[model samples]
Target chain A: MSAESITLEELDATERFLLAIADDEFVTGQRFAEWVTVGPTMEEDNVLSSLAQDEMGHARLWYELIDHGRDLDTVGYNRRPSERRNSILLETEHTDFGDTIVINFLYDTAETLVLEAVAETADDAVGSRATKVLEEERYHLEHATQWLERLVSTDEGRRRVTASFERLLPRSADLFAFDAAVGTAPSTAGILSRPTDELRAAWRETVEETISSLPLEVSADALEAAVSEPVTNGRAGEHTDALTALLDSIHAEGLPADHPASGYHA
Target chain B: MKLEERIAAGQLIESGDELTDEYRELLCGIIQFTANSEFMGAFAESEWIPRAPSYQRKLALIAKNQDEIGHAQMQYQLAEDLGRDREQMLTSLLAGENGFGNAFHYPADEWIDIGLLAWMLDGAAMQLQHSLMKTSYGPYARIMKRVCREEEFHIRHGEHIVREYATGSREKQERLQAGVDRWWSRAVMFFGLSDSRSEKSERMDELGIKPKTNDELRQQYFDTYVPKLRNYGIDIPDENLYYDEETEQWEYTPPDWEEFNRIVTEGGPETQARLDRRRTAFEETAWVRDALEAYDGTTANRFANNITA
Candidate 1:
């Protein structure tokens, strides 16, 4: 049902959900952007790159909706490191475009499903915005899915992407962690419509479908363990070291008032 | 010549044609135009690398921009294969002695502008590139084929932006329409001087290296894009534009060729700023490139097959 009022509880849930998705996009998107100047080949680089901006655009959309009443630039630019919440997957950086593809594929798959679910919400504002965001995510998912398939089809591509996946899989579930700051239940909070376990299960199922062809070391029990205890809980505002550094960098424009170097000293 | 052989041929002159001073100058102009345009295009596109709205868009824009740089690098290498060194080409481009496409000189005013330029402006380039598909220069033709394939996305990207604006909120639609209106003249001028009886065109066409005249390519661009604009409910900005029934081509009031020439030759409005950005960025990233350049054997030791080795 449509929300009658912007309850603080609902706002918290909405904020949490937006942070999770936005963090995924911000981290992964910037990593992908770095490849703009450096990709293995021109064609492959160009092919993979469209994803970077798509993710960032999606982040902006989520920010707009979640922080609806606030100034966008401030929300994006001035948030503290502790206030930021992006997943570890996007924060990891490397020179290899293949690795970049692998991370994007994983994150995009997780995000597409999350956003798809969000698109069905009863709230007109959330649903309308989610619908628009989903369109861009669809494009990113296609690019990631194609590359994932291509990587798995070739023995060389398979071995490379597989190795990268194994390294990243442990941390994949961090994308769905519930934050106290953003509240708990979707009905009460306005973020997720389902329980945490349900969202985790759904996220797991989506990841399984995409990696079904690949010889991923991700077994059913491992996925269960992952759903229960993540390698990192990003949604709870816990991030990897690299992600912390990234948050600081991304939030360079929006450092908070409490920060000693917050405003206009320069 | 074998295609593989030509990919690295560096320089080519007909067997009977000795390299004369005038011939050298003609070749220089062609090389300068190709090299400067590629670099200029790269520089222009990279501006949005940091600010692209999403991860996917950021990656795509960067990759597209990278392709332009790679194309520039290849062209520079090709020029180096001729008498000019990389330094000379870089110096000339920096000094404004060389010229890139006029469209590259304009700042990407907004996200949609980038999409529009990629779509319409790059779409116009495909007309010229298609004509060079069978050019005498084997490598340039092959490169164009690869570039053209990737360019299909640019057109799609542009179309998507136009679609979003057409269907979106009035504010967004207006911003996009205004964007299209702002870009319409530049897009028209992008195909180059329409009425110029320039000797360069006659020579390039006669050489079988660049087959289409500026007018021919401009007409082709109109025929292809005008309908696309109309389909998206976009205004053409030109009431005079129409089809010639007898000639079976588009006919329109030609752009101001003199202004077109002046902007490209002297620097487009954003040229200096764009180049400065590029130069600054390159300088900022000097350590990284330097690290790669200076590496003895550590990169290989760390990641043996890291970058498609």
Candidate 2:
């Protein structure tokens, strides 16, 4: 099951999986970057900006792996929204800080579970990259969780967090809805040592446990109801208006023709 | 020895303890202003992060803004050591009761403006920061070393973007020219007014806090940038901009001092909007800070009890 034994077909599937994750990171980083100057505090602004940069860097790493003969920008920027595989949860705009925290909490928790599973994969390249990503995700999860805990301590805070969860959780189910071709191949071939379902279960359990431990009035049934439906399965290339708008906005100012083909050095 | 004597002897003022009351106030004011400039500069640039045309530009812009915030943190921390509270300074800034650099008070509407900001505005800041690297105040001077280092990258990034545009299509070249026209006067005014005009400059020079006079730094900035701009086929906006062989200086049209005064006093096009944004952010995040303070108090008390037990 070593990476050396991974067939071209299997590697192709693995590349698809990596693409989905990279798209998620890129879109999420773009969303979080909206808070650069306007975050609730200067310190929090720095924190969120740093997290955005980290996520973008992670996306760059994944993109580089699947770049083949193309450059990172070619892979990342040239693709249309319909071709992107990021979860709808990450594409949605965050108008409220509460919504941002909820998305951060849910996405980081899921990301941590998936990365942990990937880190244990038989593919050395995948495992090493996942391990590095997990190292950064540790701080991301801690930052989200700490804020989630504090945010739920007040009635107003709790209300906002609950509302965000209610609006976002259904969309988040797409985080686990991997593409059929990519999703089943790696696990079936043993390149991905852990199945995607197991990662989803772990994510669900951790999220439930963490939320329950908070002083908020969120019920177990409510959590179940929130994620019961897979709303716009982004892993299968199904997305919403948000993704299209985000892409359009990113390219509103025409793409530069003279940029470095590969990636930014510094 | 007196403060003047210490400055004359090339002694570094190592701590707040060494500062006389007047010197302490002056140093704190200067540092606070610099910190506010960093904060505002970051805020001004933040608008373009989402709109950066390329991923490379996006990453560079974010890194540059992050550096600005980091510099602001160091400056605020330095000011705090001199008896200015970080919160109070931030509040004062948001309330428009304090001033930052005039260059940041204007709006940066176009991508070309961002390029100019990184090149021209940051280049101007580099002039001042480089001079302050030998500032008599130890903490400020030490922090300037780091700030100046990062600024080197930022200025290069700016120049890279400008070069890209300068060598681009007719439209891009036009945009670069227009951006330069808009930013030229502001960039010149970035060094504050002339030496004879400001008593503060004379006091700062005497204290070794400001090594170069405003006119001298402006001349240095012009000497470096003017020829560079002409080489790129970009016109210097000022018709009167010329080099004087006799004075060994570059003489430019004097900036509108009246406008500069108004802008630094929170009368610029985007000053009110920027301040309101900061104020709104502060107000919205008040609850989070309160919760953190409460959590810290409880944790401290628990640790204290464990020791007593």
Candidate 3:
């Protein structure tokens, strides 16, 4: 259905879904930025930093589409961790280049699937925004996939990549764990053309196929275990210490307490 | 034509061109030092990216850091044209076999120091770089034009932060003043020693490799910043700092050349830590590079072919 035909409750559901995506982008961008000066090489350093900027830019675009009245900083920095809706996977600290690549791969793969669904939505605002974000997400996926393939070629490199996948894959559950309202409202109202479960399934197929192609000893049982694991649904407001600590750090640094509401209306 | 004859003619030397051994060494040394400074400077500033007080500040810092990295890339490419490989230059830097500016040697301890770095340190750098916009080497001069343009925005960003803190709460003002006190001497020393003490100054000038003496650049820096800092109520740190009307110059207590030599040569307080971080990153990421080298090139070529198809 077109946006004009959707009920107010359905619009609210769509807004919540967009918030989760924006939060994921903002938090991940902030995390990626920590590598600005310290990337393995100058070229990689520049590329990663550019990616961080792009992610943050994507977050701004999504945040603008919501009915929230807050500016980007107000929406991004002023929120308490408990109020945030980003996936727990994004908030985990990266311990190595391998971890970075894995997270990038998983998140970008999931994001691409999610954006595809959003692109088919009848809501013109979300459909158009998804189109713009997908253009950038394509390169993000390419970057992550290229690095993943390359890193898995050597024994030691393969070890790191495998370890990162094992530790992170379980956390990928929440990327698709939309709440009942957000999960069904859009699709039921015909605002979204695809169900969240279909997008989730597509994301899993892409991720598993890519991992299976890598020259590693990852087992089918481990992959199955990761896929079936219970999820900490961030869309329903559940999060981990990582997001809490991130928000605490941001606040401790003295960002202004009163962020003017963006007065944004979809 | 002879090197000195070319110098007299004021002609730009193109890439892949030959010059006297002395001239080539001098040019390479200058450009490499500059490139290293850009890299090290960005590394130092990256420390504050996470701690930036606001989202706008965080974005600005990251953007500036990226610009510095780009500057380093351009300078390194120029140095490569002059026959220096990046690996050798970077390895030498980590080994203390290469050197950069002294200002970067000191720690950027707080947010105020970041402001000081952007305003004063970068301000000092711009004086020298602005002069090099017409440098004798064609490639280096062309790169400097771009570097100078980005640097202009950096200085404005820095000045905005400085002004914010300078006019902020008493605590912020105190921090800003303290940051200035710590950095003022180093900023003055950034231009190196007086012309009379350095014989290379005259030779470099004659070669047209250096168009202005260090003392002249230092004075120009002083002329530009002194009034600006005073307007912000920042003390210049040097009690002896004064303008000589007859000489049309500002004179101040010279920086501790002994300390400058020691820090740049022996490494400063944060130098070892910063180098250790860079070394660790380089070593850890070695596998990534190795993996790329070992990967089959045909795979990438095939992927591209599929795209075109």
- CA lDDT scores, all candidates in order: 0.62, 0.79, 0.78
- Please identify model 1 stretches exceeding 4 Å from their true place: A1-28, A31-266, B1-28, B54-56, B247-249, B289-293, B296-309
Tens-place lDDT per residue, model 3, A80-108, is 66667788889988889898989998999
Q: What is the lDDT, from 0 to 100, of the residue A138 in candidate 1?
A: 72
Regions more than 4 Å wrong, model 2: A1-11, A180-186, A189-191, A226-229, A253-266, B298-309
Candidate 1 Cα lDDT to native: 0.62
Steric clashes per prediction: 34, 0, 5
Alpha-carbon TM-score of each model against the true structure: 0.57, 0.90, 0.90
lDDT of candidate 2 over B88-166, digit per residue (tens): 7887888889888888889988787889999999999899999999999988999999999999999999999899889
Residue-by-residue lDDT tens digits, candidate 1, B21-60: 5445565576567667766776676666655543345446
For this target, which candidate reaches the highest lDDT against the unseen true structure?
A: 2
- Our model 1 lands, by Cα RMSD against the true structure, at 11.9
Q: Is candidate 1 or candidate 3 better by TM-score?
A: 3
Per-prediction CA RMSD (Å): 11.9, 5.6, 5.5
Model 1, position B79, has a per-residue lDDT of: 58
* Model 3 regions lying over 4 Å from their true place: A1-11, A180-186, A189-191, A248-266, B296-309
